[model samples]
Target: MADSTTPLLSRSNSEAEPETPRLAKQVPSLDDTIERCIGSFGWAQLLQAVLVSLAWVFDAQQTFISVFTDAEPTWHCSRPDDPSCNSSANLCLLPKDAWAWDKPSRTSVLSEWNLACAGPVIAGLPASSFFVGCLAGGLVLATLADSSLGRKNMLVLSCLMMSVTSTLTAFSPNIWVYAALRFVSGFGRATIGTCALVLSTEIVGKRWRGEVGVIGFLLFTFGFLSLPIMAYINRESSWRTLYLWTSVPAIFYCIIIHFAVRESPRWLLVKGRKDEAIETLRTITTRNQSSFRLSVSFSGISIVPETFDGNLYSAIKALVEKKWAFRRLMAVMTVGFGIGMVYYGMPLGVGNLAFNLYLSVTFNALSELPSSLLTFFLIGKLNRRSSLLVFTIISGICSIMCVVVGESRQVLQVAVELVSFFSACTAFSVLLIYTLELFPTCVRNSALSMVRQALVFGGVFSPVLVAAGRKDGFLSYGVFGLVIGCCGLFVVCLPETRGGTLCDTMDEQEYKEIIASNGGDDV
Candidate 1:
């Protein structure tokens, strides 16, 4: 018969084991770890991620609506020699079907429509300005996520602010007011994504991080899927109706998140709220019926590192201080730029293609699901650098194929586009995961924001280039693809980070030693 004290002996032995010998206990098999961590909250987390992403999709839809909405009528004065073409009895001196109606009346109607909708057109300026606000928000507010503000608070605040701004945007009295509100909304939007990413990653164990991270992004794609439905419901209603409708759901989501999502234990521990962190862990472990205990004592959360030295100049100075950090930052920024070019550029470019816009957007959105799944699988099995490089190369090859097919062969062009879309989606999904893994917790948000800013910069330029290409042919898209492809070549230089622990503090010595011994790479 086994003694009751044997349980205590086994526990003590496990605790007393040397670090190297403890490897068996320390490192759980990937599948088992995933089964435990992901199994517990995977579906719920996925739902939450999708909800967050849907907000972005609605924002995208709102941004693009201007391109599709009917242009307002414009008024034009009829020449005395030309027959009066207005339909009103007072203005129409000639028959309604006369040639004058075909020319002058049509022109007047277009002119009148333009004049009527000029205010909304002017309002569209805010949509672009919002990106500028996003850049600022990312640089300033995002860093607060892992600090005193905490992830849950910041996320809730962001959601609330965005919802309020979106609702108010529908009620703006003028274009300037609408634009200002959009700027506010953009600021909120920028902070939420990175904050949520940090929060989600923090809640799970290291082994399941990749799956959870990729699923967060899948939620963003779900948002894209939902946008058209929301737009369709509010199609006949004013643009304001769309904003109002989107805002309503967010209010409820805010409540759900407040009640359901706990503060990240990692963040809590870092902030020295050990009790709260432990309780949070207990809640999770109890729900899953897992015998896991957080090794918080050895986890090292004594000091909270500052992300920036207070001002923009200091942040810049800090970012450039180390060679490795700077190179990694540049690499992520380049990848972000390439992803922005393809993600934003492709949807718009596809609209100009012969395919139906709605069908094409759906296809593009659907393509992301598989890419995300592929990323989840590959990220677990392959080195981060290898996965990124392979996907990018495949995307580039497909993009070049798009140019070869041209518009002459519709089926061929579409097939090529489908391939490009698949590869681009894969590259984009990996980029987010790669960016997250590249930095320590202190600078993670700021680093991600910088990369995101590069992406937005690319997005800003793509539209202008696409517009110009209308006269030159699809040369712009081909060139864009080539540029992205060339950028992918840089992937070879980045360190592979697979199976690596996320750096939670700025321990330069530890980082250097790890790099030196482990081939100087990131996973």
Candidate 2:
């Protein structure tokens, strides 16, 4: 029986009975809570994701447009007196051939400017210049997405700038002006994929991130597939018209992106805009057919707490400060450099084959579809390290075989080239997904931009090789095989990221230590 009026055993008895200590409520992290809110996806969320990914479709157009615009048009010598103008003769002589272009002179830069007789260095300048611009643009503009611009703003800005410059590029009266506009367009294009990738992934649930990322690749392939059709339709039209049509539609697309897409909630939280982040999350949950509420905002809810150090040097410094991060960057960039060279070089080399240029480009673009499907499958089921290693190795071996098979067997050469391109596409797709897992949200865009820069850097040298007028496998196939094979070795250094949660800061990304303590290896 309890004593109601006996003072509950008085002060002495109360002191004798120990009180139960209070356990603090564990606050959920921004990522964890956001993931819960997004939950299973609905149609609205999917539509939003797809609309943003349309940027990649336009990106593909800008990226490979040079293949058509800068093609070396077929020509025959008009000078009956020239002895070196035959098919078997060298076409590199500047003064020998008064050329008659098979197509309109304005259809390609080479014929428009009579660069067929020009040295390789002079002839390859515009293509090389475009990649150089891409490299520089990636390096300079990467942090804007991470720092102040945020993902949607940076993406919209890049799309508009790229569209305007590409449109203006069609009006260039001379080679110098043409090359300059390409450089600026490349600069604007540098962040388009980076922004689109980061923003789209951030808005989705963990289970759906890989799926959404693959959609970007698929859309890019669709855009690539469209190029040959457009080229065929305007086969008789000047290359300038191609630029106008592609770039004009892109401008209208950018306006839609600006109005429709929301900023990345992860990035908003990282930048300390709690209210905006909450609003963005609310929008995401609403679209996903869920509801979320936060009566009390967290006092320190940074998505990138480890990256709060304010400075222009923070992104690079973050990578350099950690030994593991630096190692990861080097390994990924090395692989990226190799894959990038082959990826760009393959399409350019397609023109050198015996097939029709339009058919060849279509085949090359089509190769991306199967690779995308394989990538989608592998990304979900396979470990990142092993998948990346296997794909790159296979790509390398197939590439080298193209050289061994020789172009004399045209069917075999083309078959080998397509296989190599297909494998390269798979390697590239996996590499991108793997990279997203390796880096934290704070510097993910910057880190990825560097990786892409390495790829563009590899492309910088491709135009020179392509311009050399050699179909021999050594420069294109052999070199690509060797580089990718060797770079694939770096895969040993990276930890597997399959089924692992993504981190928002550098410390969180290096989970190897925690895994080791738990009696498991990252492999």
lDDT, candidate 1, residue 329? 81
TM-score of each: 0.76, 0.89
Clashes of 1: 21
Candidate 1 lDDT, tens digit per residue, 274-326?
A: 67766666565524433233332223223434444544344345666866778
Best by lDDT: 2
Model 2 sits at a Cα RMSD from the real structure of 6.8
Cα error of candidate 2 at position 53, Å: 1.1
lDDT for position 437 in model 2: 82
Clashes per model (N, Cα, C within 3 A): 21, 0
Off by over 4 Å in 2: 1-28, 77-99, 286-304, 468-471, 510-523
lDDT of 1 at 57: 43
List the lowest-lDDT window of 10 residues for candidate 2: 20-29
- Tens digits of per-residue lDDT for model 2, 1-523: 2332222213344455556212111212555456555554656567778988899988999889988888887767787666656544545653444557778888888878877767677667777777778887887888888877889999999999999999999999988899889888988998888888888888877777787888889998998998988988987789999899789999999999888889987787767787887777677674333223431333434333563476655877888788778888899999888888888888888876768989999999999999988877667887878877887788888888887887778898889889888988888888888888888778888888888888778777666565553756588778888888888888888877777667776655555445555796431
> Each prediction's Cα lDDT score?
0.61, 0.78
